[model samples]
Target: MPTTEPARPAHHFVAGIGAGPANLSLAALGEDLLPGGLPLFERQPGPAWHPGLLGAHSRLQTSWVKDLVTLVDPRNRLSFLNYLVQTGRIYAFLNAQFDAIPRVEYARYLGWAASELGTVRYGTAIHEIRFADRFELVGADGPVATAEHLVLGLGTHPEVPPCLPPGGLPGVVLAERLDATLAGDSGATGGQVIVVGGGQTGAEAVLSLVRRGVRDIRWLGRRHWFAPLDDSPPANDFYRPAYQRFFHNLPDDVRHAYVGAQVLTSDGVSLETLQEIYRANYEGYLRDGRAPVMILPGRDVVRAGARDGVVTLWCRRASGGSERHTAHLVVLATGRRPAPLPLSAGLAELVELDGAGDPIVDHDYSIRWKHAPRHRIFVQNRGRLSHGLADPNLSLLPVRSAIILNTLLDRPAFTIRDEQVYTMWA
Candidate 1:
């Protein structure tokens, strides 16, 4: 009998690293374009999009129309509207008359879409990506799959601040873990809680604690005030495709300036959330003698330590001096950074880097690498500085995916028309 040769690993026309909304959007748009569906390697045991952060009353900041496949291809089967109709909730959803759909509902929609796609490989973590003739996706055992091209959508993780103690103090948790921490018998609900960070996560954490009947909550923030999201027409224009094109063409210095100026468009808390938090604080004040949530803005937590089962935060005031605050529990909502690319040392050597040592991503979101002419490495949610504020936002998911798909196929696979734009960026 002839000896059988070792079987070659499974191959894909293209593969994605993470099954988050970015890759999900890309997979949805590329379903028909590729011969086989775009295979996705998701480390998650199952479909999940920020499950921990999806509070009972949390709502999406972006419109429901900005789902995985609507903006670029509304007729796609994975559209949010299609998900509603297929799941027999179209009428019920319409009847609810929500200004913005609940965040939990959006998460469910994403899970439904992922199941429908049938291309995602759950529980498979790609340890290292090595490039040869094609890209080899290495798992724990060995190379799991090979792909001609790769799309990286490895989403962000909860950012822990440097001020945190080295080993992490007891009762200090990330914003995502705050709910679970409170739900457990952690004795955190009985005492003072400090929520650090001024963004939406911080706001939500404060709101969650308020609803949990936790009094003496100190909300520390870096900004002068907790600002509401700028959802006005002119502000939204910055998220449009026309503006994306214009912003991409600007000089690096100009792009940096524009991003700094437009921070509120993407980073501010929702007006509804702010109103609810303020209302909760006021009502708590009326019910009790003191407010439950004390908003402490212009605070930069520079150092943190724990003593006697309590966490102490030394915060530098924006105006003058420093202040000390002690709390039984501390929640960090200090925003997130991109997950590092897991490339083999030899493979990483081929990639070009910018002044900041980050991969030099192009306008089309493809990283500048040695094998760019043939093999492409398109990145998602990692091009905020290079592309625009919309790069990481849900608002332009479909458009960004479309651009990457078009670049991959070397054709205008989907038309990204933004003709109605009235604001002219000079």
Candidate 2:
């Protein structure tokens, strides 16, 4: 059936590209500040944040206080707390006493907020964005809307390693589809299952396979060992607004070094998650005489291929030599990169690119373009190099939204006050 186009306002002061948490945060914060609202065009039919990746036991790494509006506007009606209250789950949530709330609850909170905002044009994918006197957002049919300014919050997609076949193999599935793929096929987990990628997602995939009674599971990682997340106080300072401000002012080389040195802070597996995997492995070994998950760290899969329903991975060991591993199924839990912006060639020509050929994002998260003075093009979650690690993290969602709003509004609409700086970057 053909889907009906939702009614649009024709022209907007500030329009957003994607309705993920990034743009959702922008919309929630700018709800009252913008003349109408920072309306968003989402490709999805409805509100969902990483729905496929939200496993039953997966808990959010960041605090729930860092929700859409709480960090900036706690009193906002679209806050997580308000969502809980409205849904009559506030008391039950508190009584449950979780250190970190389940990822499902957070997804529900976002959907609730999106419902209350009522400004998102769902099922509307912005195919092309061209700029004339005003930025024109075009969809499948034609020109969807025009805006004075645009915000890119398209988020990211799961990345599969280039070692694998371009079109993909017979049994190779992404971590997001592991559960469904396993459930639908009774023999999917009958033989050796290899999970690639050393990050938190990979950890979760291994654990999920273990819970599903898969006896042969090989968890491969590129790092020396599966490291725990650096959740210490000093490590967390990198996520603060003050540190973000400080880190941005440093030289490019220094910034890159800092990000590389502190990779574990944002990219490592959660301590709780690691412990749970170990405990599960121990108990499974006691029950079945052999461990279900084989923790194979320091192995970087350089190449992979499939032959007669069997998958073979060629890996380079960290210590030195190369090795081969075979499996019936392979789950790729590799990291994600920012989705490319759908900018027209003419508009892209006007924008300045950095040494890496990416857009040069300013301190306010706006791309440096020819018409940036009058018409700004802001980006969210696409500034890890310039803005530090917090750019891709959920910790500073509201903070980033506040900063963008302050710059877009051309006033101190929201003051980003950060105090108690114990560590100096000098």
**Top TM-score hit:** 1
- What's the lDDT for residue 310 in model 1? 86
* lDDT by residue (tens digit), candidate 1, 1-426: 899988888998889999999999999999989868799999999989898899998889999999998888989999999999999999999999999999999999989988999999999999999998999999998989999999999999777888775678887898998888888865778889999999999999999998888998999999999999999989999988999999999998999999999999999999999999889878887989788999999999899898888899999999989999999899999999999999999999999998889999998899999998699999999988898899999999999999999998999989998898777788
- What lDDT would each prediction earn against the true structure? 0.92, 0.92
> Where's the lowest-lDDT run of ten residues in candidate 2?
5-14
- Model 2: how far residue 77 lies from native, Å: 1.3
Note the residue pairs that clash in candidate 1.
Answer: none
Q: Which stretches of candidate 1 lie over 4 Å from their true place?
A: 1-6
Give me candidate 2's TM-score against the actual structure: 0.97
TM-score of each: 0.98, 0.97
Write the residue-wise lDDT of candidate 2 on 1-426 in tens digits.
Answer: 999987764898999999989899999999989988988999999988887788999889898898997887889888888899999999999999989999999999888888889999999999999998999999999889999999999999888888877799988999989989988999997889999999999999998888888899999999999999998999989888999998889999998998999999999999999999889889988999888889999999999889899999999999999999999999999999899999999999999999999999999999999997799999999999999998999999999999999998999899887887889885
